[model samples]
Target: MTSGTADSGRVRSGLRGAAWLLPAAIVLVALNFRGPIVAPAPVIGDIRADLGMTATVAGLLTTIPVLCFALATPFASWVIARFTAERAVSLSLVIVLVGTVVRSIPHEAALLIGTAVIGIGITIGNVVIPVVIRRDTSPERVGLVTGVYTSALNIGSMTTSLGTAPIAAAWGWPIAIAVWGVLALIAAAAWTYTVGAGAAWRGSDHDSEPLPVTGPIDQVLDTGSVRTATEQRAAVIETLPHPAKRWVTWGLMLAFGGQAFSYYALTAWIPTLLHDEIGFDTASSGASSSVFQILAVVGALGVPVLANRFRPRVIIVLVAFFWLAMPLGLLIAPQLWLLWSVLGGAAQGGGITIIFIVIVRLVSNDDDARRMSAFVQGGGYLLGSAGPLVAGALHGATGGWTAPLLTVLVAVLLLGVVGSVSARKVR
Candidate 1:
């Protein structure tokens, strides 16, 4: 066989051999994304006491990361374009590893700066992983893989929430928070190995070309005429609506925004809300709130199955029902907090997965995937960063949980309305 044909064969063989590794690496990297962020929360008191930080400054530890996820997204998109997705993943892990270590340095400045760096790293991974999924996975498996990807995120959050306090008790908060760096390090090493293996087998260091489009764009491009790659891309671009004008794009953004807003708002206040409203002690409230975190694994894994069986609109309705039910249920019946938490957790988890599934299915190429993912996530996170503050303010102003719960209820309603509109089948 000619060298070109032999090289092509080797590339395919290498990809097939390493297919399993990609998913494994994705899960491991995802574990680092949320674990480091949440790790400090369980020991925030320890950190505050050790570093002599005021409550406002202590709050920045978590707030900085969410802000980074929002404001740094465009930069994350640029990183993916500049460095190939594989390389970006490696770079992100390196940054996360470095940030984790820095955050353990026992200085308040180091703590805040390290959290920001970790947020930036996680932001890069957030943008690029969707690009990687779109580029590497088969069309049919996109939902399943996206589900797994999101599920890992929740697993990481839940794991860190549960484990950090005990570790802090045993060693100290810094060690407890710093220990997650091992996860980032291992994921980075594994991803680098896969990248090297693929390069070695393919005899090429370039980013893999975008997978062939199979939708309307594909039909438009494949007119049995010779066209340069640029011409084909131009043709595809002509067929699609402008990103700003597309209803699906805007709808997905709103849907994601509502989801994120609700999630952060609840996460910030649920334990306190439970304590105040239901007469639950601190320990019981915390354990109850964990139901919200742990049940997300179910929601994440279930979205793909629902996607396979139902229309996107149907899935959105189901997710919206649960999301809406949680706040309303909380407002009407504080005693049933556990049930509301379960529903809300599943809804939040499923909400994110379904939005991702739609993005993967709707975008025409890897470039579109990266841009759209960044756009949706960036907008969503920007709104989400305010959720806790707004809820807290409303609660303090009213001297009751009613107003805060009602605000979340309204957000959930908006989520359902826009999400259903967005889920309309694309022609």
Candidate 2:
């Protein structure tokens, strides 16, 4: 072949290689999001004893980051509009790295501050990663991309839950927790090169243009072209309807909120619940949580497949029942920890996946997805953050596990009610 043909072949090869990197970067960044939050749980007892922290303050360790997720959602969209998904995610990873290191300082104040910083980073990644998937992946591959990223989240949580205690026993909890920062650093570096450079390769089209950050959901509704705020709102209201006016969307948002609240509450306290209430040792408690997260990975991957076969709402209702079984089993028969963990993990993994899938399908296009996601996640996380705090305080005041388990049950019931409405077939 001639020289030009050889050069063309090299370019094609390069593009093919680059294609793999984007998904890898997405999965890697996703992996970093949950591990930091989950890491402290396995060793939470040690932290509390060492720091002389009460149950309520220890619960704040988990609550602070979740609250950040709530506060960071809208701002994530604005940051993406200003900096693009690539840069936003890169900066997020950096923040996570710094937070992880700072939290390792082994002081009460540093721990809280660092955890909050990591939460901010994770929240930004949570908002932008989906947008990046939509923009970068082909229409046919979107489902696969979504599944991959979601699975990575569970994998991160599982790894941290299972491994932290062992590592802590060997070295110390501080070292075990802080080591995750290295993963964050690696993800940040890869994202800076792959996502940033890849965005440049895709050219300066509408996808490259900065979205109008301020407005009444105008630009978010129209992906075709920029329009005046009024024109965009009229067009969106005509086609999609505002989140406030759409009862179904609100239902979906509440469903999302309920699931989030339940998941965070369980994760924050499951180890303690197993150890304190049921008389399991620390290692056993951590292993139980590991089981919960392991099954979560299965649920995340499996739910989307079932969704293709079943009505999304039916699947969601079934998932809600599984979630209910978690606290109910704990209340009625504490020995069935294994069964409850499996059920809860599967419910959480599948439920979260289904909720996001519903959000994406509810919208007409990518722009609509961004707006709906922002509203749902921003509001849902704020609602969810309260779960851990309230549960901890209840446990502190009551001196028993009854109230906290009841709280989990209530959240599950609310999730089912709203999820049913959101899952109804749209005409």
**Number of the top candidate by TM-score?**
1
Displacement of the residue 143 alpha carbon in candidate 2, Å? 2.6
TM-score of each: 0.87, 0.86
How do the residues 97-149 of candidate 2 rate in per-residue lDDT, one tens digit apiece? Answer: 99999999999999999999999989888887777666566545555667778
* lDDT over C-alpha atoms for residue 233 of model 1: 62
Model 2 regions more than 4 Å off:
1-19, 196-245
Q: Give candidate 1's error at residue 14 in angstroms.
A: 5.5
User: lDDT per prediction?
Assistant: 0.80, 0.80
After TM-score superposition, what is the CA distance of residue 74 in candidate 2 from its true location, in Å? 2.2
lDDT of 1 by residue, 1-427 (tens): 6654444333433443467777787898888887787677667667878889865576566667777889999999999877778889998999999999999989999999999999999999988998888777765777888888998888887887777777778988889889989999889888888777766654554246332334455578664555665676678777766666776788888888888878877876776688788886544555577778888889998999989888888888899998887899998898998898888988888998988888888887666788889988888788777777777778878889999888888888878889888888832
What RMSD does each model have against the real structure?
4.1, 6.2
